[model samples]
Target: MNAVAGAVQALLVIGGAPLLTGLMRQVRARLEGRAGAGIAQPWRDLRKQFLHKETVRPRGTSEVFRIAPLVLVATSLVVAVVVPFVTTGSAIPPAADLFAVVALLTLGTVALALAGLDTGTAFGGMGASREMTIVALVEPTLLVAIFALSVRVGSTNLSSIVSSTVHDPSRVISPASLLAAVALVVVIIAETGRLPVDNPSTHLELTMVHEAMILEYAGPDLALVELASAMRLSVFLGLLANLFLPWGVATSPDPLSLLIGTGAIVLKVGLLGVALAVGEVFLAKLRLFRVPELLAGSFLLSLLAVASSFFLA
Candidate 1:
């Protein structure tokens, strides 16, 4: 039963990721007073990419360049399975550890960074360097945010954390959880290459971080990378949604509950995507050098969350 539920959850994430991305784009376009691409546009884009038979591999690239997209998608799928998306009881409980989840996500980032370097292009190397620098600053805050929540539940297991908050809603109102949420929000913006960190819509070499790394990829490889990027963003948003507002998640193995949980998560995530779009409109991308300062502020917030959790307990 857990296996079936996990499969359904994973499929939802993989299939709906592009939709969420498209939805965000649509919302942003409307906010900016233009008719945006429809919400199904990403699906269409992926399908078109998959239909193309031509793939271009640079002259000096290695297997790492070819395999990074697969690893990235696989790791994200594993995370979707382990996370309490629709249900509190995961298909793989042991892998549901918060630290393990963070580590798996970090592994995916590392794979992409390596692939960027493997391309042996100046642009790729530049992107990789910038990405790693951001990762170094973002990761500590991410870990501390998780630790703040874990301190409340007495375990780093995601299920335990969700269940504890679900059974006792008071925990959600605590100082630590609020601070952690703020910190995680900042990390998500930076980690997903959103505005104020790296703009996903831009391809200019001067401002591009994620795009620079993928300049050498085409056709199927590009499709895989694009899909994986969407999935990663969706997974991060889902985590933020489920961890902070777990009201409708299934606490049992029942079919009806699972269905309701699915609906709940979709609604919650959709709202989050819209909120992100609205927020992005008011904010301009920060200068590359200024990114560290923003991340540093997040780190301080996470640190305060940790202290609040320990001292307020």
Candidate 2:
């Protein structure tokens, strides 16, 4: 039953990621008074790239450049399967440790950063350097923020933390929970290349962070990179939703519960994506040097959350 739930969760995340990206764009467009390319545009774009474009290898690039996409996608898939999006029980329970999950995500980021460096392009190396800087701050905040939640539950297994939340809903309203939520929100925005951290839509060399690394990729490789990115955004949003709002997630692996959990996660993640898009409309990208300040602030919030959780317990 856990396996089935994991499979369903992976399918939903993989299949719905593109739609989620499109929905955010559509929301942004409407807010800006534009008709926008429809909600299916990302899907269409992915399909067209996959079917019509040829994968191109840059001259002098190493095997890291060739295999980075696979590594990114694989790590995302592992995270999707292990995370308790649809159910409290992970298919691979042993691998569902919060540290393990964070490491898997970091691995994907490292893979892309290494690939970026391997390209030997100035933009790629710059992006990789900037990405690593962000990662250094983001990862600790992520762990500590989640640690704030795990403090109450006495375990760092994501399933355990979430399951505990399910049983004691009042914990969600605690000061620790609130602080951690805010901290996680910041890290998620940073981790996913959202506004105020890095602009996903911009290709200008000065502003490029995530986009610069992939400028050397084309066709199928680009498609894979894009797909992995969409998946990462969905994964982060899903993690955010489930961590703070674990109400609709399944406590048992029953069929009806699993179905409800699936729907609940989709709704929660969609609402988060929409909220992020709306917020982005008003936010300008932070200057490259100032990005660390925002992340540092989030890290401070996470620390406060941890302190509050322990002291107030």
Candidate 3:
């Protein structure tokens, strides 16, 4: 049953990613008073890219460029499985350690950076440089923010924290939890390339980081990268929803309960996607130099979370 449930969870995250991306696009379109593409638009886009023959295998690029897409999607797919979607615990509960989850995400990001540099294009090199800088700054806060939760719950295991919160309820409002939540929100924005940290919509040479890295990829490679980006977005949102807002996440495999849990998971992810769309709509892209400042602020929130958890405890 765990195996079956695991399969379901993986497909849930992977298959649902394109839809979420499309929904964000649709929401943005509506806000701007334009007719949007279909809500399933990303799936069609992926299919079209997969069939196109524009794939450019740059002459000097190493195996890294060829393989990064596989690694990126695979790592994030593993993350979706480890994060409990309909359950308070994962199918592989031991892998639900929050630290390990973050590490896996970092690994995926590193693969993309390496691939970017391997392509030998100016845009690729610039993207790789900026990408690593952001990763380097955000990772520490990400690690310590988990420490905030670990300190409160006595384990870095995400399942334990969610389960404990569900069973107890009071811990969510603690100064420590609140501070960590605030810090983690910032981390999520930086890590996901949303809002003031980086704009997902931009492709300008002067400011683009994420899109610049992939300027050389096309066809199936581009499709894979795009799908992976969408998957990562869903994974981060799931982490935010399932960890802090664990209300309807399942604690058991009972059919009736799973239905409620699934519905709740959908609702939470949908609302969060809406929030992301709204943020993107209202917030102008941050000046390139200001990114470090935004991430630094996130780090401070995380540091304060750690201090409060220790001192307040």
Best by lDDT: 2
TM-score of each: 0.98, 0.99, 0.96
Error of 2 at 169 (Å): 0.3
User: Which portions of model 2 show Cα errors greater than 4 Å?
Assistant: none
lDDT of 3 by residue, 23-94 (tens): 998999999999999789999999999985578788998999999999999999998887777777677877
Give lDDT per model, in order.
0.91, 0.94, 0.85
Model 2, 180-269: lDDT tens digits are 999999999999999999988887998889998899999988999999999999999999888889988988757899899999999999
TM-score of 1: 0.98
* Residue 218 in candidate 3, Cα distance off native in Å: 0.6
Error of 3 at 205 (Å): 1.3
Worst ten-residue run, lDDT, model 2?
Answer: 246-255
Tally clashing residue pairs in candidate 3: 0
Note the residue pairs that clash in candidate 2.
none
RMSD of each: 0.8, 0.7, 1.3
Give the winner by lDDT: 2 or 3: 2
* Model 1 regions lying over 4 Å from their true place: none
The residue-level lDDT of candidate 3 at 312 comes to 91
Per TM-score, what order, best first?
2, 1, 3
Error of 2 at 177 (Å): 0.6
* Candidate 1 C-alpha lDDT tens digits along 1-313: 5787789889998899999999999999998999998999999999888896478889978999999999989999999998998988789999999889999999989889899999988999999999999999998999999889999688999989888888988888899999999999999999999998999999899888898888988888899989989988989988998888999999888899999999998899999989998999999999999999999999999999999999997
Sort by lDDT, top down from the best = 2, 1, 3
